[model samples]
Target: HTSYVLGCAFSPNGRRIITADLDNKARVWGAETGECQLIIGEHTHDVKCCCFSHDSKYILTSSWDHTARIWKATDGTLMNTLRHEAGVDSCAFSSNDKLIVTACHDKIVRIWDTERGQLKHTLAGHQHSVRSSSFSADGNRVISASYDRTARIWDANTGDM
Candidate 1:
């Protein structure tokens, strides 16, 4: 039912799991029973990463199609999309849930306002693809890891790399 698993995440409550695949799909599964609960197949290219919101109310999936989409966790409803200039590699919710961090193959990490879907910052410094990124506990800083063999800390609000 899929090509290859790229990334996966457990819902905040730990009851559900979401898997991103190269098949251009993301599937929600019952963690305990291993049952496929929902299938999200809207992306036109390989889905790179998938994750749950901090409150477990939503799911977000990033893709090589240059979009990171948010969906309702319970019903699989499309909520919002974060589009980038290049293939997005990963996305994650801020610790406080006010923002999302998206890393891309364009050697940049972008911070997006979750509620407004506005671009916050574009952190540019890495020489290779930004493999992943996340916010610090205070949500004021960002940490990004790259295939460039370096991990950097940036100012989340300013995009200072």
Candidate 2:
């Protein structure tokens, strides 16, 4: 990365690492060798957050480009793009890896179907940018924290608080 790294995480298996940078790029690296394995430079703006799926088969990245993307961890194949009305601040996969949750600068939190790459629900209520979001351990709920000094929990499928 030619710019500052905004986020970095180790894969579940501990064999690989992923980093998001201000240069609009996310790279996967071999943990043991410290070698770059894959570079996903698809975002139009700075990449803000990056993480690997619990199974270590996928990578998720959030960006200021107004989108969050899912990728094949090993080969960097773009699997899906989760678009938002504003820059995405954070993203995470459900424990089962079947769903996704995204927090956006648009002041909304959204739930998405990971495999289909489609929107499942839009959680609206935050008065300020939603800074982060995550799925419950069982994947039945989503919790989002915002710049508004509030955090909300919603039913993952219904978008009901």
Candidate No. with top lDDT: 2
Query: Measured by C-alpha RMSD in angstroms, how accurate is candidate 1?
Result: 1.1
Per-residue lDDT tens digits for candidate 1, residues 6-70, read: 99999888999999998999999999999999999889999999999989988999999999998
**Global lDDT of each candidate:** 0.92, 0.93
In model 1, the Cα lDDT at residue 147 comes to: 99
lDDT of 1: 0.92
TM-score of 1: 0.95
Q: What is the lDDT of residue 60 in candidate 2?
A: 95
Query: Residue by residue across 61-128, what tens digits does model 2's lDDT show?
Result: 99999999999987888998888899999999899999989999999999999889999999999999
List clashing residue pairs in candidate 2. Answer: none
Off by over 4 Å in 2: none
Clashing pairs in 1: none
